[model samples]
Target: MLSRSRALPAAVLMAALLGLSGCGDDTDEPTTTASDSAGATDSPTASTSPSETAAPSSARTDFCAQIPKPAIRTALYGAAIYDEAWAPGKDADVRGGVHAEGAEFGCAWTAKDGTTVTAWLFAAPVSADEGATLVKKAGAGCEHKKMRAPGADAAVTVQCISDDDTVTRTQALYGDAWLSCSLQTPGILTRLDRAADWCDAVREAALV
Candidate 1:
């Protein structure tokens, strides 16, 4: 069975493969540059941070401190879904964004049994209806589900699971973009429960 650390990388690759059509591909390998941090693009350079290559715990502290609260919330939802309790060696990653056309990129990490689960979320242009449909489709076999906040005109949630050793994942989609969340033992259903709670919390937090 796959752990949690491997999920994010696999999802990002899949998003790219499925023609995810994001605004930028910052998470790509070092060979590719990142787009504008505020919505621009640059040639991919070697990752300067240790978390990018180090274990998840170290990475999480590095990330949690750097990322904004909103982004943290997103990551938290992902983590919750994946059953990650913030183990000693478990951590997450959140990158500076480029604000793609209608999508953006964000990542999170988790670890279990010496394995890590890294999840990626890709944002895309998905209508409220479309977002609802996608989540519904993506969240098969999960209950306590309901699509709340609609993606302003265009957005949908695209989720995936990646297990590359101790890493395991249950990705979730929002808008046309994607964000992957990694966790340990809890399967897809647990992830769904967490996802639902994530949506509810985010919606409440962003109340008008």
Candidate 2:
């Protein structure tokens, strides 16, 4: 297994993977090196639902190209406010990121509001169970619920409450990839509704 060090700077930490439950703080996600997003235009794209990612190898690679950015935007109801690629810089973190020993690369999109969603692709050896645990730890507070999303091997929802602030994160681990969506608003019910929809749309997009 490769070593995964938590190297995300404070700015990027706000947007860590299942450590997901997306975008913690409100910093603009930095752009990935051109080489990282180079093959983003490849076609006949894996539209039939991507196979579960194999265990990651020690080698580093970028696999985000397999997913289309346009599709991602549509999945966010065309309300996506931010989109960025995850590379080996500030965005890398101990879990659910490029630094996670086997992550190829990842792409994320955030809605105009505080809804942050991320799709992480891993080619390393980490299992879906391990990935879910990382997300669980990241949301260690409000509520924990295990779910069954259409294409996911395993799914979970975490709600964290700090003072009057309540944030919810719903995530699903798909083989070598995991999708997480987060929302926090003054209206708790509103936050949950959008978070659920975001997670569902992304799951459908990935499965299609």
Candidate 3:
């Protein structure tokens, strides 16, 4: 079974990643085949087999398997008030495959204290280093900082909708997967730490 992500209200965490995709230029390469050429007049007219078809108009790709439930639970650290997993087909693969803006899978853990932690993996063209660079550059205007975990390429940035405590988000790239960790608590300092912890947990699980 597949499920939708339970994220912070659209006003907060959602906007935090708004500029991430736009930071880099659109590079979706168009897919074409020899029979797609206009000059190919002798191309077969018979309907193409489903397997031979190019990209499907609508299809689903499951990516939730990449995250381990036990790891996610452990990463939450504090009491987990909420947790969920998304099954395959809940979403489509990233554009241009798992290296663009198409595939998405994630799980989240909400603490009893109103602190929320979420992890995400987006298949994109950029390597782990490239993704880190983009996030660092894209978040230049925000309160951002680079973080290094033994086995993960990561960064952390804070964005608060209010003047007080807000959400802290950590991002990392593992292989071709873009991993994200978010924490929202009443204290900014705690949130930041939690976010980092989330990243570290993800790194340990992924690198293992």
Candidate 4:
């Protein structure tokens, strides 16, 4: 089953870069792939198919499992509200289903209450804006205001109210590749604003 769990913090970025490939159904989870100038093998994800998630040989060559530790730490440092970063711990191998040679990267984020949001970065790239549109269509209800970053290969945000007390913000990014972030918590508009602000800051800082 698709985890159905909350996604990470950079989905808007992914949708912008990967196109509409990753959007639509939450059940049919999407993977991410990036092209590095360095000549290295591309790692696979449980959700990536041989055709859909595979980057051209010239685009991405390195296969180390997760984004570099420094990259995640940099993104966390950029976040306005949180001062912590997610470190790459281990590389777990996965096979079958979506693609071959799949792997998972462990990561975490600091919550408002100072608790850590332990998560994983799944390496599977889908179409740009797919995550944001799909999330809005399936998850909490909210109104999309405007495009956050222009000229960005991919960038978008959606605000939704799951209930009277909860608001959610979903953001995605893509430079040479794609990344996504989803914030689902309990609170009114205040929490959503803070989360969106933090995500925007991190996105700016994390860019190469």
Give the local distance difference test score of model 2.
0.41
Candidate number with the higher lDDT (1 or 2): 2
Considering only N, C-alpha and C atoms within 3 Å, which residue pairs clash in candidate 3? 62-88, 93-102, 93-103, 94-102, 94-103, 95-102, 98-123, 99-124, 99-125
Instruction: Pick out the ten consecutive residues of candidate 2 with the lowest summed lDDT.
Output: 35-44
Ranking by TM-score: 3, 2, 4, 1
Candidate with top TM-score is 3
- In model 4, the runs with Cα more than 4 Å from the true position are 1-106, 110-122, 126-142, 164-167, 190-193
lDDT of 3 by residue, 182-204 (tens): 55454445334555666666555
**Model 1 ranges off by over 4 Å:** 1-104, 112-121, 140-208
- What would the per-residue lDDT of candidate 2 be over residues 1-208, giving only the tens digit for each residue? 1122222232233234223232222222222211111111110112222233454332123443444555545544566554555543333442234442222344555556544445443333445556545454444334775544666666667664433334455655565454444444332433355556655655554442
CA lDDT, every model vs. true structure: 0.28, 0.41, 0.39, 0.32
Candidate 4 worst ten-residue window by lDDT: 32-41
Q: What is the lDDT of residue 106 in candidate 3?
A: 51
- Ranked candidates (lDDT, high to low): 2, 3, 4, 1
**How does each model score on TM-score?**
0.29, 0.48, 0.52, 0.40
Q: How far does residue 121 in candidate 2 sit from its true spot (Å)? A: 3.3
- Which runs of model 3 end up more than 4 angstroms from their true locations? 1-77, 87-102, 128-133, 136-141, 152-156, 159-161, 190-192
